[model samples]
Structure formats: C-alpha cells, structure tokens
Target chain A: MSAPSSSSLSIRDLHASIGDKPILKGLTLDIPKGEVHAIMGKNGAGKSTLAKIMAGHPDYTVTSGDVLLDGESILGIEPDVRARLGLFLAFQYPMEIPGVTIANFIRAALQARLPEGEELEATDYYAKLYSKMDALSVPRNFTSRSVNEGFSGGEKKRCEILQMAMLEPSYAVLDETDSGLDIDALKIVSAGVNALRGPNIGMLVITHYQRLLDYIVPDKVHVMSEGRIIHSGDKDLALKLEAEGYDWVEKEYSAGKSAV
Target chain B: MTTETKPDIDIDRSVGDFRYEMDYAFDAGIGLNEATIDYISDVKGDPDWVREFRKEGYRKFLEKPMPTHWATKDLENIVFENIRYYLSQGQVPKRTWDEVPDDIKKTFERLGIPEQERKFLAGVEAQFDSEAAYSNIKAAVGEQGVIFVGSTEGLKEHPEIFKKWFGKVIPSGDNKFSALNSAVFSGGSFIYVPPGVKVKHPLQAYFRINAQNFGQFERTLIIADEGAELTYMEGCTAPKFETATLHSAVVELVAMKGAKIQYITVQNWSSNVFNLVTKRGIAHEDAEVKWIDCNIGSRLTMKYPGVVMKGKGARGEVVSIALAGDGQHQDTGAKMIHAADNTTSNIISKSISLGSGRSTYRGMVHVPKHLKGCKNNTECDALLINSHSRTDTYPAISVRGQGNAVQHEASVSQISAEQIFYMQQRGLSEAAAMSLAVNGFVNDLVQQFPMEYSVELKRLIDLEMEGSVG
Candidate 1:
C-alpha cells in the first residue's frame, strides 16, 4: 500500500463490523494537520462506528483497514497506546466513573503519557488545569467531584473538552460532541473547542446538524452514508445539506451507486 | 524476661517474603489434643483456672461443627492434626527493639513497622509466629495510666482487667474457629485505657506468620473505661507457603459508658493462608465502637467484625474494604446487634474481585421487639474487573420494633467496557483503568482509615490490579 501524507490521520478503505453485522464499508477519509474536517451523517449511518473503530473498541473488528498516525500504522495497537501516540476520541456519551475525581482522572491520563519514573509537576499542572476549566466555565468545585457522575449533559461535554485541552493531542475526533447541549452550552463548548484550534493539531468534527458548524466552522465537509463517505465539498456543502436535507444527497448517492 | 541463646536465623534480608529457618525453643508439635493444651499451659505456667479454661475450650471445639452449610465447602481442607498450633522462639517478649531477635527485627524493619511506631504510634506490639517478640509503650502514654502489652504479659500482669473481659464478648462456643483460637490462643495485643484517659496516638500491633503448617491463634482484648477514648490499628502478613497456613484470632473489645474505641485492621495475608477471625465489641450507654477493616491477598478469609449495642444511645459502625485476587475468597461483612433503646448502627462495605476471585458480604442486623427507636443503615458495593470475577451479598436484617428503621443497599457492577474504553482513550492502560475504577469504588470508605493506611491501601490495590486486564 502506498503511504499517505505523513502529517495527517489517513483512514484508507477502512472496513469494520460488529460481529457479523458490517458497519464501516470501505470508508476512506483524511484530516491533515492544521485543518478541521466535519462528517455529517444521520443516526445508524456508521459515523460513530468510525470513531469507535479508530480508538480500537473491542466490540468492532476491522476486516481490512489502514489508520496511519504520522506515517505510523496504529491499526492493531491498544487504545491507550494509540492515545499516547496522539489520537484522542471525545465520546458522544461519556462514561460516569463514580468516586474518581475529575482532577485525578485527568492527571492519571496525563501521567500515562510521561516517561517512566517521571513525575507530573503538580503546581504547573494545576495552573494549566485551572485556566482551561475557567475558559470552559466549569465550576472550581467540579475538580473534586466524581468524573461525570451525577453530572448534567453539558457538564459531561465540558469535561470531555477539558480533557482534550489538557492532553493537546496531535489528532482528535469529536464524535457527536454537539448532540446533548443546548444553545447556551453549545456556545461554551464550541468556544472551548475553537480555543484549542491551531496549526499544530488536526481535528475531525463528526455531527449530524449544521448548527455546530456555525460555531466551530470546519474547513471542509463530507456527507457519510452506508458506512462510506459518498460526497465531499467545502463548508458551504453543510449549509446546502441543511437547506435541502439529506434526501438530495441520498438520491445522488443511490444514483452514483446504480451508475457504478 | 529470659533471653535464650541460640544460633542466628539465616535468610535473605532483602526478600521480606522469604521465611527464615529457626528452631523454636517451645514447639507444641503437630496436633490439637488434650496433651497439646496441657503442654501449652505448662509452658506458659498458667494458673489452674486458665489451664482448665483452655481444656474446656478444646472440648467445645471438638463438639461444634464447621459452619459450611451455607459457606464454601473448602473448610473441610483444614487438617487439625497436621497443624502446629504453637511455635515460639522465646516465651518472653522483649521490651526493646534492641533485645528482640535479629530475624524478627529484620522482618518488622522490612515492613516499616518500627518506623511507623516511632512516628505516629503511642505503643507497638510486634508478634511473630506464636509469641510477641517486642512490646513497648510510649513513656507519656504509660504515664497516663494506659496498659499496652502482649496478651500473655497482660494476662500475667493485669489479670484483674484482662481476665474479666477476655472472652466475655466472643466466647469459645461462638464458632468453630473461635473455639480453636480460644483453645490455642497466643500472642496478640492487650490494651486498657483508664477512666477519663484519652490516648493521643494510635496503638498498633503487627502480626507475622513465618512458619509453614502453622495455625496462628492470637487472642486480643481491648477495653476503654468510662469516659476514655482510644484507637488501635492491627496489620498482618505471612510468607507464601506451599501448604495452607491457618490464622484464627479472637478479638474482644469493651467500650464502657461514654467511652469510645476505634479499631482498624489491614489484613494482607499471602495467598497460602486461611484467615478466620472473630471480632466484636460491646458498646455501653452513650459509647461508640467503630471498626475499619481492609482485607487483601488471602486464600480464604471469613471475618465479620460486629458491635453489640447493649446500652441506650450507643453508636456502632463498621467500615470495611475487601479485595479478592486470584484463588482468593473474601467472605467478610459486619454485624450490628441493637439490644437497647435508641441505639444506632451503620455498615459500609466495598469489595473488588479480580481474576475469577470471589467476595461475599454476609451481614446481620438484629433489633428485636420492645427496643424503641433503633436504626441501622447498610451499604454494600462490589466491583468486578471482568466477567469471570464474582461477588455475592447476603444481608439478614431482623427488625421488629416500633420507631425503628433498617435500610440496606447493595449493587454489583462490572467495570463497563465503555467506562474502561473512556479511560483508555484518555491514555490509561486497561489495567490502570480497572485499578482506578476499583479504587474509586472504595474511595469513600478509605477515608475512614488512617492517612498512612489509606495511602498504603491504594498502593496495594494498584499492585493487585497489575495484569488483571488483557
């Protein structure tokens, strides 16, 4: 197989399935460094499957695929190892870890990235954490609360963003991060994500609505259906799909498939 | 205290788990019989009544059958005749670390017991195998009219207090294991706080089982007089042996009127030992008795530390954490018996099972009719590392009184795939994620332990979680 761009997260013809039920069928996409791309698809369109597959969720088996992280294949690695290699997945539905404080949970994650025998600098970590939390408008007391336990939907999303800010990953996949947030929360969360946007990192914003695009606008957009990216366009494509709905794209995809 | 001259025990000092070889000056070799009891009594020069008391205990042990109808059938594996009930290097306990034997001192040093004693303990009693090697109390605490010494020394020196409450709380006929411990009871802590005397620092006891095919029966008795308060902590560990090692201890506590006694135990037996202990305390009027226990690394452990509220307005609590690794079963819980009006009790137990390990929580709360205004709250939470791990909860609450409330809440949870995956996505390995989840399951209960113990407990849990996940 020819190597893709070394500075991008290249997913080439990724085919995966849960048990015998196929999910991602020859899905191919790329988000190079210094840019953000959005994937728009309805429910059960394999958008979430793609995100979970990249993180190596045990339930999904990759029939054939190549996921390159900066010229290195991370296809069969452990999820944590892949994460340490700079691939982060912000879950659509975050888990509630009872009794684990958000501060300690994130601290452990950061510590895992450090070299053996190296200790995290407490004072520096706290300073950075406090600043990021302040930006997200998360209360200072949330640092001591159990991670996502008894938290509102917005709080969970903000915590996911907080972890991303602390990690500063090379590549990030925001899986439906905009789903469970009201307009007020969406603005704060979008601002948090936008603050993290820069030339050093690549991001894939996966969502079903164009509303999120109005806030954290993506440089490029793609329409995913039936486990594959059927159509690709610029940011205006999202607005067109929002105005005309996926029926137009669905018809076009069927016509393209029938023609082949 | 007589010091016997013998060859030094030779073993690798760096490997704390290696058992040192030594010849016991007093060894009531293999078996439980009348002769063994007589030999032990003769060795200790026990008075007539105490000697007869042990004989009666041995007879009772033979009469009571093991409680296996509802428990695991593994109880049949313990060979009474093959166990060495008594083995000791020296009969007399040393008053100073310098006078303690080199082998025993090295063991305690490796465990960091002496350093902990110096830093935070008011007194420390280090028991090795069948006898206390060293027992000492801080001068200031001693001046405050507190008695801290080995059980043997306490029985001989302060029999008026020790003999009165020795087996009053948990008698020989309480259970099969308790009967065995009573018949062959040896070195354990005996503490007494005088009226109105408050112990500033905790008194600690460290027990080590260093011999194979041995049954360590250490009996402990603690009493807090009226208006007195004290905290006692106990920790135990044993070397890995091919054969099963038995550790059965009977501990009785007495909290007099308005007195408070807090007992903390961190039991870290090797996977080759069976740890069965009976611990109970009596709380008098306006008294409080709290038990904080942590169980780790035992082949099989059955311990239920209980409190009997005998006086009005007495408060009882039991906070416990048990971790069962491979080939381990931790059957532990709490029992609260409210015998008087306006008594209250609370039980919080958390357990983690890994690698096909099993943990059982069996609780008993009894508030009979005619007892007014009694209350109890029980919360049990179990965390499983994978599908193979197992946990069970059996809570029997019998409340037939007016104005009484008893509540029990139990939950069995596995570290969900999504939970682990979420943590893994944040960069933790599967094992670290599982370990964190397990730690979180018991984080609230850990706060009930001492600062030093909670830190050590977290480290121990982390070590146990290694290689638990694929």
Candidate 2:
C-alpha cells in the first residue's frame, strides 16, 4: 500500500488498547487537508478508540504504531501537547467543566497555544470568539454559560463545533458529532464545520450512520471492521454502506482475512 | 512618651529568625492584668466608658475557661498567662501616616500593606502587634458616609451606635476565644454603611504580628444598615517562631432589612501560629449575608463563620475554601440557623490537602419545627493532592418542619496522574498543569470572590504549586 499524498494526519499500523483488551489492531488511515474524511463502523470497531488514541488520551495505551501530526510522530506527546500541536478531538461526550465559561475555556485553550510571555489581547480574543459563535448560530449569551453544563444534546454538539472552530486545529476528529443532534442542529453544526474548511485545516468526521454524510458530504469514506479499515472508496461508499448495512462488510472482511 | 533613639538593633536579633517578624520598638510584657489593660486603655486616651468596658471584659475573660472540647484541641494547651496580651510602640495611633513613628511605619512598610493598598485596595488599616499603627480610608468612600476605622476609635466617636451592637451579636463570653478577644482585643476594623448607601469597593485590613509569644486578639464588627451594602476584606500574616504565638479573633456582622454584607478573609499565618477565630452574622428581613473565607496557613485553625436568619425572607450563604499545606490542620466550616419563616441558607465548601495536611469540614444547618418554607443546601468537596493528605466532612443537618427542604452532598477526590499527564502533554509544565487542574477544581467557588481577591487567590495557588513536584 502506498502512502496517501497531501495527508496532514497519517495513522499507520495503529494498535491501541486499554489494559489487556486490544481495541484497535493495525488500523491505518490518512486525512488530507481541505477535505472531510468519514470513518463508518459498528460499536467497538475501533472508531472511538482511534479518535482517543489520536488525541493522546491517557486511558488508552498505544501498543505499537505511529500517529503523525503534520508528518511528525505524536505518539509520546501529552494530550494537551497534542492539542497545542494542532490536533483537536471533539469528544462524543463532552466533559462538563463547572464554573468555567465556554468563552473562558476556549480562551484558555487559545492562550495555551500562544508563546510564553506574549499575552492574549482581550479585545481581539473576544472579537474572534463572538464571530465564531455567530457563525455557529450560538447565542451571544452562551459565552458566559458553563462549558457543556446543563446543555441539551444538540447544544453540546454545537459547543463542540464552536470549540473546533475557535481552536482552528490543523487536524480535527469529530467523534460522533452527529450522534445526539437533531436535524436542524446537525445542519447548523455541519454548516459551521463546512465554513471552517480550508487549505490549512483537515477534518475526520466519525459517525455510525451515513445520514450525516448527506449534510457533511465527505470527500472520502473508509469502512472500518474488526479494528481496521477493510474498504476505502469515495463518498458513494458511505451511501452503499448506509443501504447495505455493516454486517455484509464485516462478513466479507473476516472471510478475506481467514482465507489469507 | 518621647521617641527614644536607641542603638541600631541587629536585624537577625531583632527579627529573631522569623520570616514574618518585624523590627518594631515596643515595651514588651507577658500576661493580661489590670495594669496592662489600663496601660493599653490609657495609651489610647480612651474615654471612661471604654475603660469600663475593658475592665468588664477583663472580668469576663477571667471567668471564661479555655475551650477544651470543640475543634482545635491545641488551644487547650495555649498558656494564656505566659502570652503577652498587648504590645504597642506608640502611645496613640497616628491620625495620618506621616505622624506615625518611623519604626511603626517601617514595620507596615515591610509588610507591603501600603503598597498593596495603593495599588488595588480602596482603603487600608495596618495593625502592628496590638494596635492599628496606620489607618486610612479613601476620601471618596468616606464622603459616602462609609465608616472605616479601628474598633477603639469607633468606641470613642460613635459610642451610642458602637456600644449598642458591639458585643450584642458575639457576646463577651460566646466562647473562650471570644472572651479572650473581648478582654485583650486592641486593633480591628469597625465598618458601618449608612442606610441605603452602597460601598462599591472593598475595605481591607492587614494584621501583622511582630512580637514573639504574644497573642494578638482583634475584634471586628461590620453593620450594613437597612438597604445598605458593603464588602470587607481582611488578611493576616505572622512571622515564624519556634515558640508559637496565639491569635484569637472575633468578627460580627449585621445585615439589616434589604441590606447585603459580604465579608472576606484570607488568613496566611505562619505554621507556628494558633489561629482560633469565631465569626458570625445576623441577617434581618429581606437581607443577605455572605462569608467568603479562605484559610491558607496556620498550624491549627478553628474558625467557623456562621449566620442566623432571624427575619422572614432573609438569605444567608457561606462559601469557604481551605487549603492545608504541610504541618497544618484546618478545622473550618459554617453554621446556618433558620429562625424565621421562609428563610434560606446555602453553604458550599472546598478544601485541598497536600503533604500530610489535614482538612475537616464540621458544618451544621438547623431549621426548627416552627419555621415553614425554610430551605437549605450544603455541599462539600475535598481534593487530596497527594497520598499522605487527609480530608473529612461532617455535616449535621436537622429539619423538623414539614414544609422545609434540605440537601447535602459531599465528595472526596484525588488528583489523577492521568489528568496531570494529559495537561503536561499540552505543553504545560507539571507544576503549571497541576495548578490549573487544582484551580479548576475550585473554580466554582473562586469565581464567586471579588475580582482582586480571585487574582490573589490564583497567585496563592501558584505559590503553593512551586516545588510541589517530587
């Protein structure tokens, strides 16, 4: 297999696990800049595990493999350091940080990225934050609310997108960004993500259903089975998987591996 | 008394190897007696009424036994007879900073009170040992009928109002420490907001301990009149000494109808100081009272600032944060007693322990059977920074009324290395990451503090984080 050209995030032979249980076995994928990539899989198919491993989550240990951020291996870096290196993960379940406002949370993340002794300008920070919130269709007053605390499912998803848009990471993995969102909220969030698409940013959208693809319209789709990508194709693969279901792909992948 | 010029005392000898010690000129003596009390009263040129009050308080002190059972047990061992009750360099407190003696001025200057007051504080009262060496109020605030003066001066100028409520809330014999404070208390704050007036800025007082083996007992009382509001802040720092010094203080607050009073205290005594304080407040109809208390340093501290909701529809809140470092035990909490119908009270406490430090939360919320529609909520969260640290929560809530509601929640959490690693990987050093996580743990309560105080609180957390790494 040849490496995908123009890739900003490349996961090669990725193997990760929590304790003795292996979650991802030799999973490999590549996300190029200026394009949206979707990974479709069943539960426990290493979809969420891949996102967590890429974000340097402490709970999951990488047994063997490399996750490259901008062509640099980031397997040993810390989660926050991974974040500073332009890797963003929109958690499927966002942690509720009480007493920390959404605006302050995003501001702290942005501040963490700045060079030491260089203070963040309050005026410019607020101006940019307000513009991002407006683009996300979030209320201006949501800035003062606690991060994800008391928020509805759709609100949480939108908040995740808002954070992604503010951070402006080089590569973003939206883990189930469409899981809990209603139709209207899904559209707003997709629109927010679409607006942020550019030459400098690459996004990997993980979802179980192809319904979100109708709105997000990924440039490439990968079918993940048994902890690895079994098939790779264009956006039509998502629609095909949506119609045929995941069982056929899982059976065929298992048969091919066994026959080998 | 004339200013005597003595040979320059060696800085090492004068400060006695204590970080908080100051070079001040004062006639030092031990024990509390008629002579010492009379000397203190006479030095201030107190009116006959104040002298009589001091004498009466002295009698009460002699009668009240040492508190041996509640909270800090070490207080029982405090040798009252061996401790000096009062020490003042000058016979009279200067009306202006320029009039203050150079030694006393230098004492406060070393404590950084004047600079802190000038930079961000609205008003400052510096107490050296037992008397207020220098006190100043912003002219703009003074013009608004806000009184920020020492307790002794309040007795002389506003005796009618001062005496009426002086010991009414926290009586002379409320506790052993209260009795001691009443008898020997020399220099604390006296704040009164006139009816319908609001003091936008916080008035601060800095108490510096300069004398060795001396017990500094300061009495503070603040009265927010009907429809008035005020925010008062106090900080204490004592030089370290081998022989521990005793500090017992009493603060009483009264919020009248439709009034609000927020009292904040940041105590940073050295590890050799025994800080035992009793602070309480009374809220009347439609009034609100809040106590934002932080206990950072002290060998043993037994302080529980509480509130009594005495009038209908009154509200009371106590948000306390305690951080106990090495060789410290912070036994602090709050008490809320609902005496009137429809009264409400809420208490939220957060404590952090590090390096064998122990923090205990002993809180009480009482709503009698007669009170209807009373409500109470109490939550306590404790974080252990390391394995050796310990934290405990003891909440006693009793509600007898059928129409009342009460809730209590307590949690103990340890700092996870995984969380720390996650933050460190984000380019933050281990120390900086831990500080952020710790600050985030208490951010809910810290954000409730006034802006300047929150900034200072964060700085204190940073200082604690220094050298915390193994």
TM-score of each: 0.96, 0.83
Clashing pairs in 1: none
The per-residue C-alpha lDDT of model 2 at residue B346 equals 95
- lDDT of model 1 at position A32: 92
Docking class of 2: incorrect
Give one digit per residue, the lDDT tens place, for model 1 in A1-260.
34688999999999999999999999888889999999998888999999999998989999997888888889989999999999999999999999999999999999999999999999999999999999999989999999999999999999999999999999999999998899999999999999999988999999999999999899999999989998999999999999988888889889988999
DockQ of each: 0.84, 0.22
lDDT of 2 by residue, B334-370 (tens): 9998999999999999998877678999999999998
| Candidate 1 lDDT by residue in tens digits, B356-406 | 678999999999999999999999999887666679999999999579998
Give the per-residue Cα lDDT of candidate 2 at A100.
Answer: 60
Score chain A of each prediction against the true chain A by TM-score and list the results.
0.97, 0.96
Which 10-residue window of candidate 1 chain B scores lowest in summed lDDT? B1-10
